[model samples]
Target: MRDNGAIAVFGATGQQGGAVVDALLARRARVRALVRTPESDRAQALAARGVELAAVRIDDPASTVAALEAVDAFYFMTPEADNLEEVEEEVRVGAALVDAAAAARVPHVVFNSVFGADRFTGVPHHDSKHRIEEHLKKSGLRATMVRPAAFMENFATVMAPSLEDGTIVVRMPLPDDVPLKMVSIKDIGRVAAALLLGTADVPGGAVEVVGDEPTGPRIAAAFGAHAGLPSRYEALPLSVLRNDLDEAMFRQFAESSESPADLAAVKAVEPDVLDLAGWIRSTGWTAPADRARS
Candidate 1:
């Protein structure tokens, strides 16, 4: 077990931070969550669970510094875009947080980055995370960076249209044989929380984390089994999908699917990490009836 100390978690209401908070709490670590609106239900629930809630806007340097006071470690995540200044806002918030971490002299920092952040620049949001990673490395802070692969939960959003109609649509253009790794948001939290609470001797390093590498057809098969339907996976050309989505964003997804990181290397270090099938079974998704009833 790791020593119990106060840790400040930014974006505590969101997926990544929420997972970290749960993990820390499970390990009996004192957690301080920074939120923009403390009265929000999510914030209230966190407080009820024994999390110390601090009201602060990530973009405000003073507020961030105040929240970071006396924190042993920090978890940083940024907001996503909805087609407007998404990338720029993420970069700004990230830079501000790092600056505050430095000023507060926080000893340990962990950041959630996207897959292919170091190489793929087709999308601004992913690239924004890369910039933040670079900044954190040069800031002279002991940091651990986790670059997660495409989230399994993304199917709920990206493939929702098809799910609603009892069909599956492949929006990004990629070869049928091209394989991409996917992970559950829950697993991301589990691994992150374990790292935060364990004295695993990881400092000043980055890990490419993935759960499973499955091709488009394989993913469709998984979803089909869960949904209890004969779903079809069709590879839509990027040019066709571009008519409805941002071409730049679509291009980024295309590139990432084609050039995924080595899962063997990721699993080698984190041997206890969950694979796709294991994640599905643990999350109760294999049986659609159970998932819906829950």
Candidate 2:
């Protein structure tokens, strides 16, 4: 069991924050989740699970400060929107939250940043997280910024329709040998909870989170195994992707395939972290018929 601490979880109703809250509860940590709607289904479920519900909008500084006043740590993640202005707004909100947490004298902050956030420039939403990380470091607060690689859950997003149609589309141009790291949301939560509950000695640290490093072919194989179809990854050119895809989405995917960072660092610390094969197996999906297509 991990030590209990009063941690304020932002975006608790969403994916990353929801995972964090679940992980915290599993370890018996005291969690205070900030939800905009206390009566919403997600919020009600969290309340039922013993998380303290604090009403606060991510953009409201006073509400954020009040929520952080009594918490020892914070788990921060902003929502992603379709527009650039919304992207900028997320950055502004993150900055505001950081300021409030610092003002409240919170000892630790855990930010869910994206892989290559420190260097990527084309995608505004993805890049905004890096700016927040910089602000947290300069604020003199003990911070652990986790830059997670592309999520395996992304397949569900892109291929959900294809799953219904029995087909899959490969949008971003990734070479057969280009390696990409994929992490599960569940593992992200587990690692994050461990970090929050552990000693707060390592400040100003940035950790890259990943479960598996797989190539396009490997990914196709995994998908095939899970979906029971002859799935194959077709390499689409960047020009074609740009014409058919959202600019921001295409840019984010394009840059991720080229990131050189190793994900073994996080697994080294958390040896029980789930791998891609284990993740697929856990989902209880059947393997495809033609493994050769992958």
Candidate 1 error regions (>4 Å): 1-3, 161-173, 201-204, 225-231, 239-250, 253-260, 268-272, 286-294
TM-score of each model, paired residue for residue: 0.84, 0.85
lDDT of 1 by residue, 1-294 (tens): 224558888888998889889878887889999999999999999999999998987757899899988888888887875444767778889989999999999888888887766655756667788889999989998888877877777665665425435453444455576666777776677666656655443433777778787777776676666656765567666676433324565555556666656666555545666765566556665322332233
How far off is residue 201 in model 2, in Å? Answer: 7.0
Worst 10 residues of 1 by lDDT: 285-294
Query: What TM-score does prediction 2 earn?
Result: 0.85
Best by the TM-score measure: 2
Candidate 2 segments exceeding 4 Å error: 1-4, 160-172, 199-204, 226-230, 239-261, 287-294
Residue 290, model 2, lDDT: 29
